[model samples]
Target: MTAPVSRRSGGRAARKAIREAPLTDDVRPIRPGMEGGRYKPLSQEQVEQIHEAALKALETIGLADAPDSGVAYLTGAGAAQGDDGRIRFPRSVVEDALAKACKKITLHGRDPKNDLELWGSRVHYGTAGAAVHMVDVNGREYRDSTVQDLHDAARICDQLDNIHFVQRPMVCRDIADNREMDLNTIYACCSGTTKHIGTSFTEPDYVPPALEMLHMIAGGEEAWRARPFVSNSNCFVVPPMKFATEACQVMENCIEGGMPVLLLSAGMAGATTPSTIAGAIVQATAECLAGLVYVNAVKPGHPAIFGTWPFGLDLRSGAMTGGSGEQALLSAGCAQMHKHYGLPGGAVGGITDAKLPDMQAGWEAMCSNVMAGLAGLNMVYESAGMHASLLGFCHESLILGDDLIGHAMRCVRGIEVNDVTLALDQIAEVCMGGPGHYLGTDQTLLRMQSDYVYPSLGNRMSPKEWSENDKPDLIENTIARKERILSERSAARFDPLLDAEIRRKFNIHLPA
Candidate 1:
């Protein structure tokens, strides 16, 4: 509230604004040992073992056709590239990247540089694939995408403090210009609304627009310098594989400019990668090593995230389904390999083949997301249909996933150690006093939010009360939440002139 034109006798308007309370040093409390969440994290011992496995895979069997520039660094440093295209790396290369990689980064939310921090105990999430799909606030399915849907989705994502970053479309069908709508929409949505964005420059000339937009949110050079632009770099390294010149060039630019990269290699068993988990891990390890070498070569200290996915393809369909159990195993293995490099691990999740959010969605998403989370993925991609090797996206899954992410978060909240939970005397007092009272206490009032995640999509009311208003299920609640969010959401802003300029620069137009 602002001061009144006239002051009251008590000088009520003169009180300095006080903070709500100090922010908890949550990062420290939730490190290494203690457990608290929907599932258990790998023990330190397990993490060590996985890391070792990744090292062994990298040194003896490096990675394949990993862009020539990347291979030059590795093989030049004791790696071996076989005729088969698999360039096996030495343990030293993995150690080198990890040595140079900034393990912890704060990926700023409002300013790309001020936002996110990795390498701490903080768990982060984001998506990297394209041709997006979106859901409006009212739970309406908006096929392909429009600037309107883009604005609405960005608004909702902007509102959710839970989600750290917004990847461009969940799937944008507006491919009039090689997913250029995706390019502009991603920039427009993230600029003023949030600091972090998940994107890739589609062409060599395509980078300026996206980078400028990102630079806008980052404020200026000092800010961008501090955070450095970080993004998803799925190093294409499977059957019939090689990185695109544009992809490699953009990646080269990112490293040269000191931006961070997530070197990801995805494949499906038998079709693109070996059918065995170990083979897939080796294959993925090589791919990540290849990417790391390129980054490390250009800018030695650039941050790098290591990852992979060897999801099995349904032989008949020859399509990668997000819900495959193999996805869980692949993600788990990827986590191990990333650890091998002593780099942050990343993977994909919130997957399913239901073509919609239903039981299949729940199962596939729960398994992959939960496993990835528990396995301690530094950053994991969330959303669905990405099944055509992450080429597709479904809207309903995105909504249902909001709830799933909530649960995943709650699972990882960890045990609390505040004044109350520390329970130095209160618990003893309650026990001695005979625990009869259920309420009417200061402590209870102070801890409600911490104790519960009041649901937006769970069954909680009496059937009588529910029926009176016409009972609705979780899906309905999800739909309603979407509607409410869209209706009330304040759309974010962008530089209209700058946007117009970018339109001219790209020579692209939105379709009707």
Candidate 2:
């Protein structure tokens, strides 16, 4: 179903005349940060049980490999360290931290209008992945993703109405040096889009230099701190109860640098986590809750996203199947738990195991994207462009996924039932006095732009019309759309002088 397209007249003419418009400053019927907790995969009792189980796990099994500073902070905040070096949190500590956790956070964009207020079950979809290979549409093959590719992807996302934020989707395989890669990733994303960007750091030290670049972009350290446009996607924990030592340190630095932290716990079900969906949620919740306590211990009420991102594994082949129904349920269940705690949280969705953006990719992407929004996930990560279980990123697929997410957000918006929406008067007038059909109604025209969302790349033609139009393929259309967007659109969102200064100071590989 498409968003309500404006009609010039009736039937075919209206359909044909529905032009694909540019992204405007006007608010859409379905927009970013819409509340969406309509679907509940887990019951209240089930949520309570999972919460209890997670608390029990933290109290009993505990977590291992806490760095010395982490040990100090956690212990000082009511965590106990055993002789075996496992740091265990008492239930009170966990509860205290949960109470202290920031419930509402504004992930600011350099442009103030793009800021995302993450609170409750407000839904937002965006790009995110760590794909090593880029899906070359012209060549129909995978190639090393470069910094330029990342920048281009960001530029594409800036024009996509459905994509709310641009996270680092693919790694820069061109940059071998880890520090250079980290810094360039930040620069490319910032220079490409004004939307809030999400990126990862190699180590705690890499953050300071990256912050310097961010400071330059924001004009000063104070301005950057006041409206930090980028967040650290820190995977602070290894699955099954252990801290990633370096990642935890990196999280600390990000918290200190006035950057928001995504306390991510990505455990693959049936492998790193339990096979059952509830068990996986329990483990992920426990890990991220522990992360919450760690963050609170460092600084109370710090803005940290409760990222419980657990993927599904095809047990038969031991391969990651991000597109599976189980993965969708897992994400929905995790979102439920996040809501139970009243914390701003994130989950993965719209990932595809398909090698290409075919019918299989469409079904897979739509299924999870719809489910994730309905479940009210605050940040729907990897909601576009990921393919082959996230080994590759496709620009064409990303563009198509925007249309898919547009429909999904429409689902999240659901139906509005009110006095005007009841429309009994209109129905009476149409049936009794008016011409048999409501085709040329004033209400229809008035509500057209406000009530509906139209896809730029989606085809709405009849079979004969489609044949007459030369049977345009969706992929080809998406490819043309991508080319048009990249060629016609501005790749550089930053000022030319600022970009030049950035290039002059840093070893920036992306062309100006």
Candidate 3:
């Protein structure tokens, strides 16, 4: 008689035999560019009222501190400079700029497959922060983030299916000089991943050197301009309506250099802006509208995201409360305003006040992310791996966020009520003729992989099995996954010749 087959070996063979086929783009349940707008927190009238208020603010209150060049650009485009030294945009000018703005833009990635189309209410999640600290999960302590940490974060984002782009999420404390820091930030992110990157420059002068390194990576300056893989996340507005002088100059340079710009207006409620939610939105909208005029004045119809990232504050303590419900509503409201103008927009979401990636972090992250997606935000920033109200970044938390964003995208996809999905016949067959369940049915098997999302680290084991399997810890398991990925991932997709040229030309900090 044959020796009895071992249960463990038999189980492995059975699992291998039943493994599902590979998935294709057509069958992917969730993906970048999925339309949102299913959740509308503001009525149409309310949106229009806010728009009117914003226009009034721009035409009346105006913006202060526009550089001489900016004043010239704005005045040439029908904006008036008052005797008080403020630049006032005529309502007509603002409207014209909005009409001429690039309604749909493609954020090109160094890898063509990672390109993101920004139009409609399509939602794309990605990393965005300037977190200075790195959370040491094992030690449960925070330390200054380094260039290595930035590169590692990019690499992690490159592999995560749900994170569509890799923006500079942390600053490199190792690089001392400001100019050096800017250039190295570019190198580290590009070398780490080919996804579309968002980086900021300290001054206008730093941009050119950074572009040269990018040119070498892109094969030439002309190629880099054609499919410029990086965008300038310019915080053009200081707050409650004033131009950040240096940032405005940087914006001008980026526009002239053929790079996309995110016209960022990050006003904080109850502090820099009005305490009321609607009032905060009005201020942010007015500020971003001025940004639109600035961009079009510089170069009409140029690529820019209508970025209105107004943050919330704790009224009691006057501290920023990024994870609060008020912050979520603020972001969602801004998304609605973006939809109103039919311009590509970006907003902040998925931030957590919790210092660690525990249950508190989970609830806070999911709340903002779900609302951002449902509100039809085109680009949702800070959607992963941010902690302690954006002061810290964690590698393991980034890995876990991939799973969180997957579920959020599923919500954006909503339900399809097609005839096939209704499956009246399948239901009847299961209830009347087939076994009391439909677990092994053809339709069930066909829809399983396409219609469902499985978390990489989430637990689903029954109590008995969990105890038998030693009750794994989510954080520990996620750390293991992070290690496996970093170990198995190939070096950045850079040509050896170009990489060497980049090093010779610039202060490249990342190791070859």
1-512: candidate 1 lDDT, tens digit per residue: 98666543333323212112322435222222122223333455655665566567666555444567656665675567788876766777666665776665555455432266555334665544554554332454435555555555566666554455666654435445744754655554554265466655556455555566556545665676676544645454543245444566667766655566666577677777777666666566656665666566667766766657556667777777667877777776566555544566677776666555557667787787767666666676754323334544544445556556666655666466778688657666677774755343556545544454444465666788689777877766766776787777354554577556555655443421
TM-score of each: 0.77, 0.96, 0.96
Candidate 3 C-alpha lDDT tens digits along 279-386: 999999999999999999999989999999989898898778888899899999999999999999999989998899999899999999999999999999999999
lDDT of 1 at 338: 56
How close is each model in CA RMSD to the real structure?
Answer: 7.8, 3.8, 2.1
10 residues in a row with least lDDT, candidate 3: 12-21
Q: Candidate 3, clashing residue pairs?
A: none
lDDT (Cα) of model 2 = 0.91
Candidate 2 regions exceeding 4 Å error are: 1-27, 489-492
- Report lDDT (CA) for all predictions: 0.57, 0.91, 0.91
Per-residue lDDT of candidate 2, residues 111-189 (tens digit): 8878999998899999998899999877879999999899889989888878999989999999999999999999889
Instruction: Give the Cα error of residue 499 in candidate 1, in Å.
Output: 4.2
Q: Which scores better on lDDT, 1 or 2?
A: 2
In candidate 2 the C-alpha lDDT for residue 31 amounts to 87
